[model samples]
Target: MEFASRYLLRPSRICFPLLLLLAAAAAAAAAVAVPPVAQQEQDRIGRLPGQPHVDFAQYAGYVTVNASAGRALFYWLVEAPASAQPAPLVLWLNGGPGCSSVAYGASEELGPFRIHSDGMTLYLNPHAWNRVANVLFLDSPAGVGFSYTNTSSDLITSGDHRTAVDAYNFLVNWFERFPQYKQREFYIAGESYAGHYVPQLSQLVYEKNIGIQNPAINFKGFLVGNAVTDDYHDYVGTFEYWWTHGLISDSTYRILRIHCDNEVSEHPSGACMQALETADAEMGNIDPYSIYTLPCNDTGSLRRNLRGHYPWMSRAYDPCTERYSKMYYNHPEVQKALHANTTGIPYLWDTCSDTVGNNWGDAPKSMLPIYQELISAGLKIWVFSGDTDSVVPLTATRYSIDALKLKTVKNWYPWYDHGKVGGWSQIYGGLTLVTVTGAGHEVPLHRPRQALILFRHFLKNKPMPES
Candidate 1:
């Protein structure tokens, strides 16, 4: 007040022009406080084709993880409600070693939208996980969905290591693109081959953040559904699931146990392959991904279902489900709205890439080592399973968790949802395992309500509710 009075009293000495300039500069600084975020604005999605009205902000675009390799990963960020700002960020992936998260996770499972049967319109999934967190669905490894790589050979050797490294790079660059999300509580989640992707990426992110006091990634923990862990365990548990579920004969089971017991080779011997084929034949046309659900009768998926272990790449997409994703994503306008296909790649976008999965070069025999390291680091790790899924069934997950040998913190118990048994849960020293009774390969797709409940608990770092 005194300084202002002195200025007022000494009006003759005051510089009016300088004062005006100072005021103008202050106004400019105030305007800049929000940050223009030009690239983020450019990537903003106006609306997707036939997408229903939504209040939350949405963005979809490519972030270059490798310039020399011409590799870029695509991502779709569906933010939480305005009130949920400063909430945690969740990255969801779908494993095919080559699947598109946008096609599956976003369009069908945990994301905000689901495509209608006409393949032209969309409906909001009430159970969308984004209601609690900012959900990011990424098409990773530069070869799936809208992601691209000019270096042709990259896809052939896109193994676990490269996938993890590139994904870390993507997160680093993506944070730059949306700087506000940097340093937010972050998590990685997925199902299927993503069982591989989720952990590999989590380990990389955790390692990269070793020394930084406040790393931008700020990774919290991870959760996976029916993830592939140890190859031997997965194989053994899978065969058992088939037999116990009555999908295969006792003779076939014995042959499998005899010929497929070798843990060394993921590609079993000719004899083991024959036994697996025999088992697939006997299983009939049921969707092995979800034993009870009706299989997609589409000719392509139908033939592929009978292939050995290959059907793990296929989910329970009926005639209208994944079929709808194909039609909606392929529409040029849809791509335009999402800022996708900027390079005009020759191939049409697909839900999964056969070339990438077929040529995956370096899959470690086991992810148990990574699990042990992360667990000891005190990172929150949770694995959930759809009990009915034969591909990576509850038995497989249990065997893998057992191998971790962590002391049990809470014994197994039924978890309730809406006054009914939703599933079963057991909490270990550094991990939690839950099983959704009748869910399939993709729990969110089969039991969305239960999946959402599970997501809420994981984010809270709490165990599933006991009835």
Candidate 2:
């Protein structure tokens, strides 16, 4: 300043001590402001092959979750537009216990781009969730997608508990890598098997932040779509959905009820397997996940099956999208742009991993207990179901919510979007349940416009619009 130049900057006052203090102040400022932006630059996606031009910045890379085990998880973060900066951060997971959230959640459902059939090109998603909030997609559990561990044994042992811990670790490291998001309101979301992932992680975050007024992660609440909630309720509701929807015969429904109840879904008994097989056969070539959509006609072997009967849960209504992701992600050029597969993973990338899911070690039979704890803690919770997904149908979600026994704050009613019914919603004391009309397991993929409305309402913690 002019005054500082005349008084403070005099030759008499500006000595060795003054010079050193100025240098220290400059270094401290650089340490706080310069590095994080530079690190984000390193992860910036310059461009994707045949990708459409976009205004928002995108970054993708690995965050090491376990140093001792050389384990890491992959993430793709699509930021909100400049106008939405300081927006809430939402972490989206896709459940296979082993699926890549980038593949499903990012590319197919809510991310900005959809892979072209050429697998080498991309298109913008009109209803990407990033329109309203910063969206982060993660490929969790060291063995899924591009995420890997130097220790091969870790792959076979991927389970609910370990996956949650590693994801938490990823958040810790990721915040250090991009400190701007630290203390930002955060939420986790997923579908199908992630029904388990989202809530368990929510519990960990909620418990860890018990005493801190401003924890770095600042986890607020969660939203899940067509999620697997509890074994007994899921079993009862799934079988009932099949029979009432007329997808299975009367006799098969009886068989499922008799054999499935009380049986751990992760380890179904012989009688339960027989009943499920009968149901599968009876359902025919229709996609069980969507129930109404035609399946991808690639070779019969190309169908991505869910882990055992757990999700038969949502092989999803991907049609050829999964195939496109397989083709696109395996391309060396796309991988390079995304900064993925850096260590030369021996196998090609995939949308889902059967090995990881089939060998999953520690899936609990229920997530209702976690729901109880988080709900009591006043964490915002919302569960949405696509009415048509036989995999984790609305009926099953209803049964699970009924088991929670939360008092109803608002009776069920149709929620509207643009003058038409989008879905039905009900508000409960500590949670909310919404049913997206005509949607399948992948709600955003099936009814994107309605899904976007649901998401906007969710982020605002407002009830779905009755208009």
Candidate 3:
């Protein structure tokens, strides 16, 4: 299976002798008043090996979630520019059941910088989400990214429930380390499989806040893009999308629909699997994440090395970015600079971990019940989609939302960005549905500016701009 395809099925551990070091670090941290600025500076990224100097502050480190199990989740925090006032805290996660948010979210998408073509350097992302909020990117479940565990069972047995619990534990401990933002308005954002992560985590946070007069974490809302919300709808929409886009033959589509419709579970039967295989063969080698975009060739060379003008050349998109990220992250110096790869993980850093993806358990067929609960609780909720994404396409998202039967507050309309129609949105009583025109599975990577605008509106609890 292709790397991205495995993520659709996406899916941690522990230790002990390190207590002395953690106690010493805690003692040292407690000894000082450590103003917010100074404490942030303490976690400051002095400089990435080849990154450009920037005015904003950045921090990367780990928070031990299960000390007994020696499971620690890594995080990267990019504070909003000092002049932007005290911005809200936004926890950003990338779905893969096992993908690294630090790799994809921080470097490839909405973080302050993007990995350069050389794989050793970085460039500013002018539309980084941190411009409006303190973006916190986490690598969760103890086996993704730099996060690891001493327990082998954590790696092979991780599922949705454990992941949400671990993530919540990470946030509580993270707040203790940086108490400055404990009471700040907070939000959760993520994409893809995070459709599960974001809502599940949000629900936990909400439950934790009950009866607490002054909760340290003031979670305001959440947003998800191109998320996997409902398995049945996702399956139907995906097949329909393939057939409509002419990526699958009519026979394959019919067979898939016959064998897979209403198959709520991610696991499919032998006949269904065969039909999907036929559909995949019909789709060929195109990048399923972004059907309209060119697939990255397996050649190790960077696309920037090509001097001639090519139709696929794009300043905003790089199909080979995952390759660059792998090279950059595996560099020993880079790992040291980020405070990652601590304890010397046996394996090299990867964009996604097959072990985690393959072992994922407890993924419910639908998140609709959770969405209904959150909506009833009056939390701000927004769902956005990248129209060009074949994997978890807009059709899937629309179908899932439609199942909610939300009262429409505003009929569908074109939302503008700099006077150009960026996408379409429909405001409902408790939710909003949005589509980013021409974007793919990773919306921010494909349409950074529009994604930023969408994010700003989401945080502000305002409707998408229409002109």
Candidate 4:
């Protein structure tokens, strides 16, 4: 099946109304900027059609944040509804540390519509996320997606720290443009590499809040799904999951069990070899049965199941064809706004540099430093998982949490509503972790109802329901 087909299910009737209410409220209540700024803001707001533009209203617009990066990069903002109260603004970031949020999350996963192959048209995803809160999908770090930088070197070397800084600056600037949202309980949410993005950014916000002693940042919480939080366990889980699912041969499992070491980072170590031997043996019959585990040929498996592998990409939208280009690149207004040539870059914009010859030569490794910084500052931190995901497996997330040694209640009982295994929640210390059954990398997309429940609990600053 094509990539989009795997995740391109019709939106959920159950969750669509909530998203619409939030989006509508936010748009209606938003105070358009005044003066010259007012005119532009009004015009941009005007672009938001009153009714039935598509599945959801498409307000293709950009925010210019004042950043140390010098030039203001372009970012598209799509609001569900305008609310008078300045509804909680959820900043959605898509990972790859290099992908476009609009193309992936909005167009494919939780946005209002699916871009037809022609791209000019759209189909509504009933399950679009805007129903919950005012969702702002961002292309960050100045180089990825619609956001960009003129300097070539900047494009070649964007790292985690730079990403966090740019994103933090972007939030500050975005709030400035629409100041009403400044105190609207902000959240940093994303998936995949975002495992890295959300936590680091949260740490910065937490630290800044402490400095002013006034909680200026107001970073309420962060949500990441199928995140790559720790490199060590994530990699190990790949092979271990493969073995458990019967995708690798018995002999291969033996090898992996014998040599599996979680910390070797050079070219695949002896442990990795053991894992690979098992993966190699069971490559062909692995699938269908092995859909839940990481495949033997990671690269090849991804290519074969690109759509399924990456839940964010539009299974339907073609980045090249005229229809697709026009919707994005050729949109006369978007073209003018971007200040780019009539024919902009072909592929969808990725926020970070995915340029050739650009490698993150092991500079420094410190996940704990950032985690400690956030904890020391008292930021509301949340880490959730799709119980079934092998990419950033629940086991790995569990291991990471164990190290935290936060106070715990041994909270691991099933939560049911209308009598089915809805999901489960656990609260240890101030931090929280919940696992949604049957969800994969993108929890929100896969398990919207449960994900929404989780998010709502976070917004309310309440512990997840104890069932």
Worst 10 residues of 2 by lDDT: 1-10
User: Which lDDT tens digits does candidate 2 get at residues 62-99?
Assistant: 77788777676889999999987879999999986667
Per residue, candidate 1 scores C-alpha lDDT tens digits across 1-467 of 01111000000111111222232223223322223367789889998889889989999877778767667788999999998777899999888767889988999998888888788998889999999999999998777777777666776778889999999999988898788987899999998888888999999999989999999998989999999888888878877898999999999999989988675255467777788778878988766777776666644565445434433323433434777888888887888899876533333667877567666778887889999999999999999999988777888889999998889999999999878899999999999999997788888888888999999999998889886
Q: Against the hidden reference, what TM-scores do the models get?
A: 0.87, 0.87, 0.90, 0.73
Residue 165 CA error for candidate 3 (Å)? Answer: 0.7
Off by over 4 Å in 4: 1-51, 54-71, 80-85, 116-118, 213-216, 257-262, 270-274, 277-353, 356-358, 361-366, 463-467
So what's the TM-score on candidate 4? 0.73
Residue 166 in model 4: lDDT: 73
Candidate with better lDDT, 1 vs 3? 3
Model-by-model lDDT, in order? 0.79, 0.79, 0.81, 0.55
The clash count of every prediction, one per candidate, is 1, 0, 11, 31
Kindly report the root-mean-square deviation of model 4 from the true structure over all alpha carbons.
9.7
Candidate No. with top lDDT: 3
Superposed Cα deviation of residue 66, candidate 3 (Å): 0.8
| lDDT ranking, high to low | 3, 1, 2, 4
Which portions of model 1 miss their true places by more than 4 Å? 1-36, 298-319, 343-346
Least accurate 10 contiguous residues by lDDT in model 4: 1-10
